[model samples]
Target chain A: MAGNVIEINNLTKRYGKHRGVEGVSFTVKEGDIFGFLGPNGAGKSTTIRSMLGFLGYEGEIKILGSDARSGHEKLMKNIGYMPSEAMFYPSMKVSEVIKLAADVRGTDCADEAGKLCERLKVDTSRSINELSLGNRKKVSIVCAMQHKPALFVFDEPTSGLDPLMQNTFFELIEEYVKQGTTCLLSTHVLSEVKNYCKNVAIMKEGKLISCGSVDELTHTNSKRVIVTADGKKSDYLYKGDMNSLIADLSGKNITQLDITDPSIEEIFMGYYEA
Target chain B: MITLFKHEFKQNLKSLLIWSISVGTLGLMCVLLYQSMTEDMQALSDSFSNMGAFSDAFGMSTLGIGTLKGYFATEVGAVHGIGSGMFAAIMATSLLSKEEDGHTGEFLYSLPVSITKVVAVKIAACITGLILFSVITGIFYISGVAYLGENFETDLFLKYMISVLLMNIEIACICVAFSAFVKKNMIGAGLGIALLFYFSDLICRISPDLKDYIVYGPYSLANATEIFVGNEIAASAYIISAVLIIAAVVTAFVKYTRKDLAS
Candidate 1:
């Protein structure tokens, strides 16, 4: 249990008993793309902030086999963080911001910065204030990934990205994983997590209500089935299955059914509904 | 910490330039005025008197308008005192609190540097700024003294000048400490300067009997004349001021290292 790259034990952060986060625990193995899945305000950001040593809390966290509180700076040097809401000076250019970040972090990654910029198709010449949300996200992503840190802590890194750019991000993540880097991805997008993460932890009401691999969590949950009958009538659903909600559309509806597994979103919803 | 200091210093070079120009130009202008008026001592004295007690309080009398201790006291308590102190205050406040206001602190917290390092480096930068004001103004003082008379005691002026330098550093440290607690640059600078100048007068108005107790005050430091005249500089006043500054800086460092930056 202790053989993990990141180990959080009994972490509790309370703001006048408002429960910023409470008694949350988790472990991330080396090279594990761990997904911290939760909706907004479900303590995802709180957990990440605490782990980064930005906040004092009543818990012990370790990063790369070192205590997060006592060994924060040394451990964090190996991490790349992309905050959910990225804020940069309006007057600074993207290139300028990236350079400043690298300077402060004691990293020299001009080549990596350039390569990431080129791959993401980001225009680094524009001022941050003049950038669109998606482009701003691109700047943040570039800043986070430029140095190829050992651990990548992303907070909604893909929220504003287009589908094409999202695919690019996934490619980058995959590339990084191949290089033996770990990722602790925090996001509400079940589909993205399901596709890319090796292990997933789900949170609800400031607690980890359910967590595990996609297959393990959803094995007994409801399966979705879609059937294509004939070209003339394509709508179809089984009418007699008590475990399923069936709908048979008339006029160009399917005449038969094709059974498929329920998506990660449905499984996540099921945890709350149950 | 050195890296942090360098980063802060580079970031503030422009502001330093502006302050430098202001001080340089002001010193140059005053020298020019002194040059034009040295022949007419009565006219100079009348002009200096007309400039008001506040101007006298600022050390404008150091130009030898009447060649009196009152003029030197005016210079010690007023111009160089307030001007240098305020400059140090601005520099220190801006260095510590701008990160929070710009939301840059959020991003920076994620980096590998500890907040302790950040605070230490920033304090060093504040001290550097303090020295800049003091050193640059020392240059002005020497040049102005040279303009006044060839026989002025350069050694005494230099010795007295260290007290003023230390006075500026004391003010800078207090402002930086205030900035760390408040986490707002403008408000921290405003309050720090106002408190430094205001409390000095407030204690004076309240009566000399209460002077020693207002240890949390920097107006005592502003009393550079008394300190430079080889007096003890009121040991309790300076000690109290030192204690307040140390407390602020320590608290800021502790808070910065542990404060949750999510917001």
Candidate 2:
């Protein structure tokens, strides 16, 4: 049986009148790709920040079976974090930047970095300022993965990446998971979560509204109904029996009717609205 | 910590070079011009000394402009003093705040190193940069004096340079303290602080009533006229500078350690 790699309990952070996160609690098992789902301001980053010991919070957080804050420096040696927007000194080349991070970690990641750079198509000689957004993200990916950490925390890691690069990124992540790595992935793309993540926790307005296995959350019988009748179309999520839905719509001058299962995004939106 | 220090020092090395070279060259040129302006300076010195407060404010009366030492005091001293102060201020002010303002803290603070350690290393780097600036600028001034073959008191010049370095460290520490409290890069504020102390020092010199309070500002300790004429800087000025440096460093460390870094 796999043990929990990350356990956060009753985590709350507040600044002045602004609320960062409230009563957030969740756990990620070892070797699991845990999807953290939320909108732009839904406290995903705040939780990640607190877990990384970047911000002080009221509650308990344990990473790799040690207190997160007390053992931050030790735990960080085994954690790789890729921030939402990758930024580096404009004058430094990508290779220099990678070398600095490796030096900070006190490890020589040259061979792994070389492989990742080649796979990601990142130019090592180009200065950071000269690289495009996607290329910078690729560099960030290399930095995060080159060390082969036990846990990976990536926030919106694929926003600027193209489809091909995104695929390569996930493939790399999957390979790491195969080697007994855990990942806490925060993203807005629900399709990625459905495709790659086994478990998920959904947040809304600084609160975790739903959390469970991906199959449990998306296994509901609710289907999206799009009805075009009387020269007008009506679209909404329907949870009633299909016969009842058809009987109710039979009296209308229905030109077209389409019913399909709701994707994880729609299911998660239901929680947000609720 | 060493890696961070090296990176930070390299990052600001260009700015350091530009500032030190420009100010050092200016100081050297001022020293070289003394010989060419000897006759004109002699003619102006007598009248200048009789100008009362105007001469006193600029040290023309106390340190006469006819001699090389006095000329250097009244000219190169002011240039180097203001230049070094501004350079130190500008460099230290944005040293820490730019990390937050530019969103680089997200990268730095995420590393295994503690925030306290990072802050300490950065302050050390700032002080090291100031030391190098002093050394480079001092070499330029010494070369100028040596090349001219003029009779000058090396002791007084060294004392003045040491005091200037202390004054710069004082300003840099204060700005570093301010950097911890601010989220944006405050280069303008840093420059303003250097100018404010300078003009205040000038005002104190011009006004006899304000003379007793000269120790309140950093410029008093580095005053060219005072140092070149072998006048002792008030003991209270040194005490105050020591206190300010300690207090500012303590404030920066405490504030930054607990700060919720802006993302």
Candidate 3:
């Protein structure tokens, strides 16, 4: 396995008396799609901001082998961050904004930016204020991917994108990750993580509750077993091996039987409930 | 830093032009009025003298309405001073706080730049806007005076203009520093600071004893008439203004760099 691209240890951010994120620790290995899952106000944005050095916080965060707080400028050169909300100067055209971003990063990303805009169907001639929410999101995505940074930090990256565009975005991410670019995707949605992410960390109320692969998490949780026999219907939570479950149920003379693995949503809900 | 500075300068260009045009128009009107007022200078001066406390309240007690320099100083200079100061404060405050208010802070802060560089470039942009505004207004005022065939000392006028520019920059730095402290009410805070400084100067003028204490006000530093006539130049006023500006800018840099930018 490659080394960790991002390592956060005991990270905490508090706003006066309010808890932002407390003792949040996680790691994303190079070339891995790591899902950071949490509900709204679960400190997902807070943690992302801390990693970007946009806020003051306790504990440690290292990105690309440098401390985020002290080496943010150097570290950010290799990081492409898409914030939850896409905002730009209202009076500036999309092209102007993209050019400004490219200029600040000291790179010539014109070709890549043009290609991304074409792929995403974004109109760069119009002013930012004139664009719709989805179009603005498309602009943001183009800006993030144009320079082709080694690490990507996307905070609810597909919120405003349409279903079709969301699929395209995932494909783009998959292609980039195939090239060995690491990604940290923060979202409240479970299906995206389950489908795309290799590993996931579940956070609730500013605390990390679980971190593991999808299969491991689902295997550790109880499975739903359904049986219909003699005009009676029953469901059971089966935790043991399949052979043991079959032996225990063999005497029931089942007319119909269905065994199913729980969805990621169900396991996530269990974590919240716990 | 250069990219950020250019972006900020371009962003504030429209407002800078508007303020310049407004200040220039007001100054031209004041200059035109000066021609007619000069015809009945004695009567006007006597009338102002008879107004007693009303004239004193507006700082007309020591003004000589007969002279072109005094008339321009008391009327056009006062308007430009307060107007430019207010405009500078508004511009600086908005430039500093608008990113967070408009939700663009996240985008800008995420770039490959230090917070110090960002703040410094923005401040430089604000200073550029103020300079443009001051220069535009000064050109109009000088043109107006010349159009009316008035004889005025060009050197003194330039010195007075420089003083006003310095005062505006000082007021802007103060407001920009205050921007780091407030989240939403930046405009209000800026206006409050400008108004308070102006009123404090007014009170100091009305009360002889308070003059020593209110010397930090921009009005005290950039007193147009005092600088125009080559009368006693308050060197300490310039020193104090410079100190305040330096202190405010340092505070802004420190606070903004360490601030928890939630937006």
Candidate 4:
């Protein structure tokens, strides 16, 4: 069995009267792309920040079998964390920034950085101030992946990326996952989770609402129902027993009936409503 | 730690050069002005000394302005005192706060470095800036005196320069402590503090009742009039400066290590 790479238990953080995250717990197994799904104010970033030891929280968190708070420095050696917004020194060139990060860690990532930059199409000579948001994100992606860390933590990584670049990012991540790297992807895009992630944890109002394999969470037995009865057509999401849905519609003169699995997006909305 | 220090120092290099050059040029002008104003200064010296509290506040009563040493003390000393203090204040005040203000702390603190280590490196860089500022300004002053071919008291000059550097360091340490508590750059507050200390020193010198209390301020240790006239600085002045510097630095290190960064 694969060991757990990240284990967070009963994590709680508060900003005075405001809630950050309350009793949030989840575990990501090694080599798994764990999706962390939440809306704008659902505390997804808070959980990630707490796990990375950026904010003080009351709970137990273990990354790679070490205490998150006490083992921060050592843990960071194998962790590549990309925040929602990538801000670097404005005066430094992308290449210089990459080199500085590598130097700070006492590692020479010149070859890997060169390859990543080329693949990402990052303009090495341009200063950070001159780059657009998408270009800066490209630089951020290269910085995060160039080191080839054991675990990757990306918060809203695809927000500023183009569709083509987004595809390239997932491809790179897939390659890394094949090599046994674990990732905690925090995003609201359900399709990405459905396609790339094996397990998922959905957060709402600073609490974890659902967590399980992607199939299990989205497999809420919900289906899209389209029926035409008495020359009237209707379409709606149906949940519960298939027999109950069939029995209710049998009494009516149903001209046409269609049943199909609901998309992950609909299923995700179902969780929020539930 | 060295990597962080080097990066910070490089970022601050432009500000350091600009401040040091501006202040040094002002001091050099004062030094050079002594050559052209010799006769006029000699005539004004007696009248200036007789002017009661005004002359005492600027040290014109104790030190004659006709000579190079006295003129440098009264003129260049005032310029360097305010200049170096403000420079130190502005640099240290914005040192740590800019990381968060510019939203760069998220990038920096996420590295494999502890908060204490980062704060220590920043403090070290600030001290290095002060040292370099002094050295650059010192070169300008020495070059000016040499060009004028005047005989200056080397011992007194060295003592004055060292005291000025210490005073600047003391101001910087306090400003660093202030920086740790604030999220935004407090350059205005830093400048205000330097000016406040200066005015307090001037007031204390002019009033006999406030003279004993002067030891509590940084200006007490580096009074141009005192140093240029070979007057011994009080032992208490040095003791207080050391204590304040240590206390401020310790406070800053502790506060910064505990406080949440604005990421």
Clashes of each: 15, 0, 0, 0
Regions more than 4 Å wrong, model 2: A226-234, A241-243, A246-259
Docking class of 2: medium
- The candidates score, on chain A by TM-score, as follows 0.85, 0.95, 0.90, 0.96
Give the runs in model 1 whose Cα sits over 4 Å from its true position. A1-3, A89-93, A103-107, A122-133, A223-262, A272-274, B35-65, B68-77, B140-153, B186-189, B192-206, B211-216, B222-232, B235-238
- Candidate 2, RMSD to the unseen true structure: 1.9
Q: Across all candidates, what is each one's fraction of true contacts kept?
A: 0.72, 0.64, 0.89, 0.45
Better of 1 and 2 by DockQ: 2
Q: Which stretch of 10 consecutive residues in model 4 chain A shows the poorest summed lDDT?
A: A137-146
TM-score for predicted model 4 compared with the true structure:
0.96
Cα lDDT tens digits for candidate 1, A1-274: 4258888888888877598888898888888899898878889888888888877889889988888888888877888898877777667789888887788777798999999999999888888989887998888888889888999999989878999999999899899989989999999988887899878888877887776776687666355656565554333223245443443334445667666666667767776545
* TM-scores for the candidates: 0.82, 0.96, 0.94, 0.96
Model 4 C-alpha lDDT per residue in residues B1-263, reported as the tens digit of each score:
88889999988999999999999999999999898999798889999999998898888999999999999999999999999999999999998899888888777876778888888899899999999998999999989999999999978998999999999999999999999999999899999999999899999988989988899999998999889999999999999999999999999998887776777
DockQ list for all candidates: 0.52, 0.66, 0.84, 0.65
When 1 and 4 are scored with TM-score, the better candidate is 4
RMSD of each: 5.0, 1.9, 2.3, 1.8
lDDT of 3: 0.86
Identify the runs in model 3 with alpha carbons over 4 angstroms from their true place: A227-257, B49-62
True contacts kept of 1: 0.72
